[model samples]
Target: MLAWTGGGVTLLGLVMLLVLAASRGWFSPVARLVAGAVLGLALLGLAVWLHRKESARAGAVAVAGTGVAALYLVVASGTAQYHYLPAAVGLVLGLVVAAGGLGLADHWRSPALAIGAVVGAGLLMPVVTEGWGPLLAALTVVLEIVAGIVALRRGWPWLLVVGAAWAVLYASLAAGVAGSAELWPAGAAAAAVLVVGCALALYALVTSSTNAPAYGVLASAAVPMLVMGGRLDGWRGAAVAGGAAVVMLGVALVPRLDRPVRIVALTVGAVALLEATGLLFSGDVAVAVIVGEGIGFAVAAALLRSRPTLLFAAGFGVMGVLGALALPLPPGVLAGYPASPFTRGGLLQTGPLVTGLIVAVLTVGLAVAMLVALARTGLLGSGDGRAAMWVVTGLVGLYGLTGFVVGLALLVSPDRGGFVAGHAVVTVLWTVLALVLLARGIRNTPLRVAGLVLVAAAVAKLILFDLVSLDGLARVGAFLGAGLVLLFAGVRYARLVSEAETATGPATPPTGVAAPAGGAEQAAGDDGRGTWGPPDART
Candidate 1:
């Protein structure tokens, strides 16, 4: 701490010398620049000599860092402030100083010096350029390449993060305040950073820890993405995000790539795809596309047998369902098209009808894929996680089934009658599906609970939605159909439960532990085991 403090204090004094000297006319511009350079060289010489003695090695590195900062100040002031050196000369000198400082830091194993070098240079650029986008962006590119190469060689991934943060700050300002012509340079800078960071990620990917390099790769991608996303969020922005998605996916898919990096890439790619979908499509069409993509990701997860992949699949699938409810109904549907679906035209001519059908199919697929992924990854735990999944999948599947039937009914009937009939079909479908799930659930408690939930939802919809949405025979048909289905499902599930209980009766009392009340009692099972209580009570 003392060493660093001394270095910082000395660096500040050098700045004061230049400022105070000019104000007092104590030296010419050349004299002031030469004097600063001389002081910086003296510090470097002192650091080298001190490094020979183990006791002073730490202080030596700190002083070397101060000397690096001193050189940067002199070069920057000479070029931009006093006009002593040409801009190119100043930039070349700056890069040289940065390179030398980083090399020393790496060689000395001094992260403190490395951080100071990258941070000091990054902070000074904005001040010198006064937020000029092109220059700042260009310098950002050069600085990243220099700093990143040196840092990665020493397994220093965090420096890249520090460097990228500055790049992003510059890129953001450029994207927001600078002209369009200047934005591309910032984009280029981001691309450069990502490319180099990827190299770091790929290096020893099989053995090296995944977190450090993965963050570098992600941050490298974030610069242009967040900046461009905030400002250029239409097709142009979509294009950029889509391009980034493709790049990251390529990085992720590389053979033998780190798992964390691959998962990160896939996750970011999923977001990018949805972002593009929103930019390109609206309402149900957008929801359908998002759901479709999510389904595809789910299947990929299953094929890969990856837990992280499945988790993302579950998230995106939920997002689709939520978005469906949050967003308004599609074009024609909003205008009461379902009541008389085609007063003007046919199914092909009705945009919302077409979109509704598409969305319905994808949404249903999303549910199925979620379960398949969970099963693939052995993630269907017998706990709340499994139960929540079942419930969510049931709702998603119900939404899809209802949409599909409604769309089909509207297509065939194209009147209020068809709309009511479509809903009637929906109710029937829900009841039948619930019965299947319940039968399957007899052995899986969570599945049974999900089936019961569906039954409740179907009953609610019949009462709340169908009672008002339909009329005349449509209402009667919906009610009678659902009621009969419910009655049949109830009888069938009851019988199935009885059969299951009879097939697996309670175990015989342990040896020397006599049956309750009397040593011998009447038994119900053919195997001589008794089952005289409610199924749950016996268990």
Candidate 2:
């Protein structure tokens, strides 16, 4: 009873502390460090107490508490800036507490606890101060370095790596280090620090026991880098590109994500969006940004290519778009696109076409490589609906590109029938993929809704593509096929929605663990690998 009470109080304390912190305007990184430390302490105490009295419930309570604490810290860090001392202090204190807590509490010495402590500490530094501030700032830097060493020596999963990087960056800044953002410093001190941080980040990404820790470290590292690159402009862009390239290479050296590769994919997608929107630059620096993005995307796409490869592919796509946007052209044309070279009224007015064709070929080649990688993972046949969706979208993109090329060719020949044929083929393929997607949606409620919307859109597209010109039996056949597909999909969607509600009804737990059809080959490898398993057997 005492253990249960302690666990309950600790859990409540964590929620209240964060709520209070946010309410009090301490939503910065410093607050996160402090909050994480406090939460880790509370969880440690609860885990210890529970183990002594509530043995059967201990694992559940401990895992839940630890996860909650880690998640809260991740959220806080993401929202907060890195230059706040309070957050850094929280990080250091939390690391110490976690290290001590895990070491002292028999029940809490599990690898998950140790890893959380290290990763939590590494994330806290930027939360505290951005390598500059007052006297306490210097101490924070030194302490983080020391803490990282301790954590590393004690086998704290990714601690030594992430911690070391954070510490060296702080130490360099404290030692009056300065470098133009556009370039990796050629100076001894700055270069050393850069190299060390790169090494550490790569080490964590490649050697960490689990993707969770690697994700946190890499995600956090990417933030400051892009921000710094954005501010510095020239060499910074180059450095950022180089760093990202290194990370992409390192990702190939690591094991695949045991869980769904969703997080990495989302991160890639977000970065791609940022790059595509020109958020990567300010002035003439935009030129360098474009060049770097082009190279980066081409290189990244050529590298990472698997189920986990989604992140790099997305990032590359963004870079490709941004680079295209950066190409020099007339000041007028499409709203977002630069004018075609033809508008300049020169003999080489078709320069964009030639350049675009070259870029297209390169991009297509990389996309094909990505497809091959995904195929190797067997993700295409895995029946993992999400993978299926990704594959379908990829195929659509390929067909669309092919259609564009064919359309361009037909424009010169003025062959209306050929144009119709291209559209018809694409429309047919899309209809089939759409039906499959809708079927897959039966198990995924959100996808099911999206599928309905897509089906409607596809029907409209087919009407425009086929019905308008078809005058005979072909028109009837097209309408009949499309109508049957839509009707069947509608009926299937309705049934799935009803099933979803029932499946999520009171007595049933959410089906969050829908592993792909291969029976979780990756998770099986995680057994004894010091990773947190499903909620029931956390460590």
Candidate 3:
């Protein structure tokens, strides 16, 4: 507490002296900056000298003095009379002094100095440039890259976090400033910095041991910049970002890289590719890109023997199918048509109806292809992996079946009445499917569990949705039909279990165990020695 208080008081005194000098015009801006830098350096040296004996005090003083000096330089450079070069020099000197403090006796105190130096330098960029977007963004990127390198080499992971935070801040500012015609060049420059920063982050990920968190942070920070660049430059910006993402993905494929790191890289790449594809295409083609990428990811997962990636691919594929359902059909194909499927006269005239069919067919084909590929690759050997594969298959099947049913319903009924009737049909379909699954579960546990869940869902839907929306006979029929089906399922399952047990016959004691006296009479078809014998021998 005392050490902190002393450092705080010292920092306050330095700030007061700087303000007094500026108010009274006691010294030139350059002279004051030089003096402050010198004083900060002297204090850092003293702190290092005392570090062994009083490490905490040394750290507090070092952080306070460095922060104060850097602030002075930033404020001075923002003045009309001072050149930007002197402030830049002072900022660099402060960073050097902070870096030197790491060599002191305590490892814990070094992060404070390192984070403060990087953050202080970052804060100075806008003041020095008077908020010029391009220059400030570029400088911030360069600073972050340098800081990342220093931090990685020095093993100060916190400094990487500070750098990543500043990178995001400056990238956002650059994106905001990019909206003006006068700042178009700045936008281009900012875009370039984003790409370069991503590359630098990738390199760090490859080379550094403790850089996993930093890589994730940097990649996350770069995504917005890439998006803004695409928005600014249209197709060209998207192409640039896409290329960088592909490169990152390629690097992630290196055999020696850690699995977690590779997964992160692949994820970032996939996202960037999707965003770029959206910029480059429209309608069905964009949807196709999603499906294609999903399939590709699944294949990669199979080849790499990665379960997590497989799950991701499965999820992505499902989303693509859903997106396809919502997407509009091509204008040429559905010209002069009512937009709503229910308003159309038939399935042929309904755009969404036709699109849904196409999407369903495509989803089924892709799911089949993924299953075949995974099976051929022998990737489903583990129980968990096999379970995941089954789940993916089930989800894909459900999506396709739902699409087909919905489309067919819209085709047959083109009004609200038709819509309600179609939902009722869907309810019946779910119930029947659940019964089939439950029967199949006699041989398969997973299928049985899935069947049970489906039955529960059908019941919930019948009560919650169909019961209220349906009227008169339809409501009564839905409730009655669902209840009967559930009852039948329960009876069938019990009968099968009973029959199986009966076929196995009565239980017998082990050879080492003595039987009760009445046990012999109960086994009338057996020998008197308690071993089963032919019927003729028993008679």
> Model 2 segments beyond 4 Å from truth?
1-147, 156-194, 197-227, 251-305, 314-349, 359-367, 381-391, 394-539
Q: How does each model score on TM-score?
A: 0.73, 0.39, 0.57
Looking at model 3, report the run of 10 residues with the lowest lDDT sum. 328-337
Name the candidate that leads on TM-score: 1
**Model 3 alpha-carbon miss at residue 347, Å:** 11
The best-first sequence of candidates by TM-score reads: 1, 3, 2
* Comparison by lDDT, 1 against 3, better one: 1
Error of 3 at 69 (Å): 5.8
lDDT of 1 at 327: 49
Q: In model 1, how large is the Cα lDDT of residue 287?
A: 73
Supply the global lDDT for candidate 3: 0.60
Taking the tens digit of each residue's C-alpha lDDT, what string does model 3 give over 124-145? 5454445645545555555566
Compared with the true structure, all predictions reach lDDT values of 0.70, 0.45, 0.60
For residues 239-300, could you state the per-residue lDDT of candidate 1 as single tens digits? 76677667776665554656777877776676666666666677766777777777877887
User: After superposition on all CA atoms, what RMSD does each candidate show versus the true structure?
Assistant: 6.5, 21.6, 9.7
Best by lDDT: 1
